[model samples]
Target chain A: MTARFAVGDRVRVDDRTPPGHIRTPWYIRGKSGVVADMVGAFADPEDSARGGDGLPERPLYRVRFRQTVAWPDYAGDGRDTVDIEIFEHWLEPESG
Target chain B: MSTNVDDHDHDHARTFVPDEEDSLGQYAIVEMAVRELLIEKGVFSADEFRQGLEVFDKAGPHLGARAVARAWTDPAYKESLLSDGSAAVKEFGVDMNLTELYVVENTPRVHNVIVCTLCSCYPKPLLGAPPDWYKSRNYRSRMVREPRAVLAEFGTTLPDGVEVRVHDSTATMRYMVLPMRPEGTADLTREQLEALVNRDAMIGVTVVPAP
Candidate 1:
């Protein structure tokens, strides 16, 4: 399947906190970042955790966020960044 | 040789043969029973399990060191490694088919660090099991929040000008840091460079020391 988001596309992580195992970390929820790379498609880890077939794989992207933007109290250099591999379902196009 | 024989005799004299009844916990018993049931049901043979264990036993950080050393010596290999890490490692005969591998390079301007905040998902095929600190709740929680402080605890103090990029291995992708080759090592052979790469350096906990 083709990737929904291409590299350099600005996307925001969905803020919903659904129950069960999730790949997106709490710190990145609702944060916006540009897609660094499309890491290809894979089984949905959230479904796999519950013993499901995890079929119809979803594309995963490495989202890069500035450290200062992720954490208000980040003490490191402003240029520092954090990259998290997030499934396509957890991301949404950033709105103007 | 005489001392070895005496030690063997001393071990044989110990009569503390503990059976199932003498065990303090039932976890091992349950594990063995489940394993036997699985084997009997043809899920996997006992021999296959033993072979898997042997493969795991043979994998360690030394394999990752070899990959790093090769990348340092070969510019073309380093480019391929940075682009397709999983495939590049195959040149060194390391197979990591379970998950996609990404090689993040460390330069003079940027230093890379890796962590699994959700769980202890590591590049076991290349670097063996994750170190105790890598799997600890403290490291998982604090690394992304305060990386400089956490790295300092590991005795890695980066310069203020260097940008620290922390990669969280949250999905099926695993990361390995291709640390910068130390100074005064240009004359060293690949084998010599391999000796300098350690488990912590690949994990980004510490930098490779100059030889």
Candidate 2:
């Protein structure tokens, strides 16, 4: 599947709290970050976690979020960042 | 009282060996049951499962150390490792088991650390099993929240100017830190350099000490 986001694209993680197996970390939920890299396509992990064949792969990206943005009281250099792996479906394009 | 083996009574429980299955808890029993069901169903042979276990047992952190040492010595190879870590490790015959690898480099400007906040998803093939501390809920939760403080607890005090980048392994990607080569290691061979690297350094908790 084609990746909806590209490197440097600002995207916000979908802030849904659906019940069941989820890979996205809670601290990262509802946060916005820039796509760092497209780490190839892979089967949807939520599908695989439930014993179903994770076919129709989805694109995954490495997203970079500034620590200051993620945490209000972040106690590190302004340049500090957190990189997380997020699936295409968990992300939405951020508009200025 | 100093007891001697020669004068000891030979009254030990000989036939009361503890069976592995009997000692297992509910989860282990379920795992054994599932394995037996799969084997009974001819999904895979017992020998295949045994061989897979043997292969996993042989994996160790030395594999990752060697890879890091190679990267320290060879710039071109280091570039490949930083770009496509899974493929680069494959060149040295390390199997990633279909998981993608991200090799983050530690430089003067940046210090990198890895954690699986969701669960303990580590690079077992390259760096052996996850250490107990890495699997702790405290480390998983705190590392992302206050990385610099957690790092200081490990005796790693990064300068204020150096940015601390934390890589949360929340998805399929596995992370390994490529520690900066120590100042005095220029003359050391790759094999010698490998000796300086340990599991903690690769996890980004510490730096490779100058030898």
Candidate 3:
């Protein structure tokens, strides 16, 4: 599945947690960010491990999250941002 | 290239261990299969794998310490470090040709920490393989969000008035913390100073010169 979010689009990572192995680091799971760039599609290793071969490759997105949103009291320069590369399966569209 | 059939089988048989399917058995199985297949196809000789494993085995904990020591002693280098980290590393005689080296500095106001949210992107050339805890989801998730909290859990508690900055490692890049050296070690030699910078200090969970 191709991720809907693209570079410069404001989005929030869904907070839902699922059982089993995941690649999304726990630190940025529920944090929001703007999509930076899309890494080419690749096999979802987590899904492929679960007998999901023939599974279509999914596009990966590089999401850039502001440091403040990830940390409540982050007292840095306030312009600090971190870019995270997440698989398509890990993200969903943010609702207004 | 000695392509003797008997020698080829002998080399494979020596490296292949039974799959216990427990602990690191899966990794071992995969490693053995890949190595054996590659060797059989002459992608790389058995000697290459042997030499690689030897080099890895020879790696010690002192590599990271040596880098830290050089940074502490050189002021111009430190400035270069703060400006362009990877380039400054070249001044120390450390070759980071294979991987990207990220230098995170620790200041009085803010402490720089590093975590690989995905897998361990360790500076194998300098710091060697990462500790198992580094790959744990618990470390990746809690460290960035609640750095102080996570540090405390790891038996590291900073005093009041210090800020924590966590750098999440993604892609092929690796990170190392340039910790603030403790006082009273001024008279020590470079080797002595190197001993003070621990792996935990580089990880930013603990301060240097563990006293």
- In order, the Cα lDDT scores of the candidates are 0.91, 0.89, 0.72
User: For model 1, what is the alpha-carbon lDDT of residue A54?
Assistant: 85
Q: Provide the clashing-pair count of each candidate structure.
A: 0, 0, 1
* TM-score of each prediction: 0.91, 0.90, 0.64
lDDT of 3 at A25: 73
Worst ten in a row by lDDT for model 1 chain A: A52-61
Please provide, for model 3 over B33-106, each residue's C-alpha lDDT reduced to its tens digit, 9 standing for 90 to 100. Answer: 99899999999999998977776764445777776787789887767765555676666555666455667688
Candidate 3 segments whose C-alpha is farther than 4 A from its true place: A1-68, A71-96, B1-27, B83-98
Off by over 4 Å in 2: B1-23
Cα lDDT tens digits, model 3, A48-92, are 657786268777676777789877787544554556667766777
- How should the candidates be ordered by TM-score, best one leading? 1, 2, 3
What is the per-residue lDDT of model 1 for residues B91-187, given as tens digits with 9 covering 90 to 100? 7677887797899999999999999999988999888988898999999999998999999999999986999999999998889999999999999
The CAPRI-style docking tier of model 1 reads high
Best-performing candidate as measured by DockQ: 1
By lDDT, rank the candidates, best first.
1, 2, 3
- Better structure of 2 and 3 per lDDT: 2
In terms of lDDT, the poorest run of 10 residues in model 2 chain B is: B6-15
* Clashing residue pairs found in predicted model 3: A27-B141
Which residue pairs collide, candidate 2? Answer: none
Candidate closer to the true structure by TM-score (higher is better), 1 or 3: 1
Error of 2 at B169 (Å): 0.5
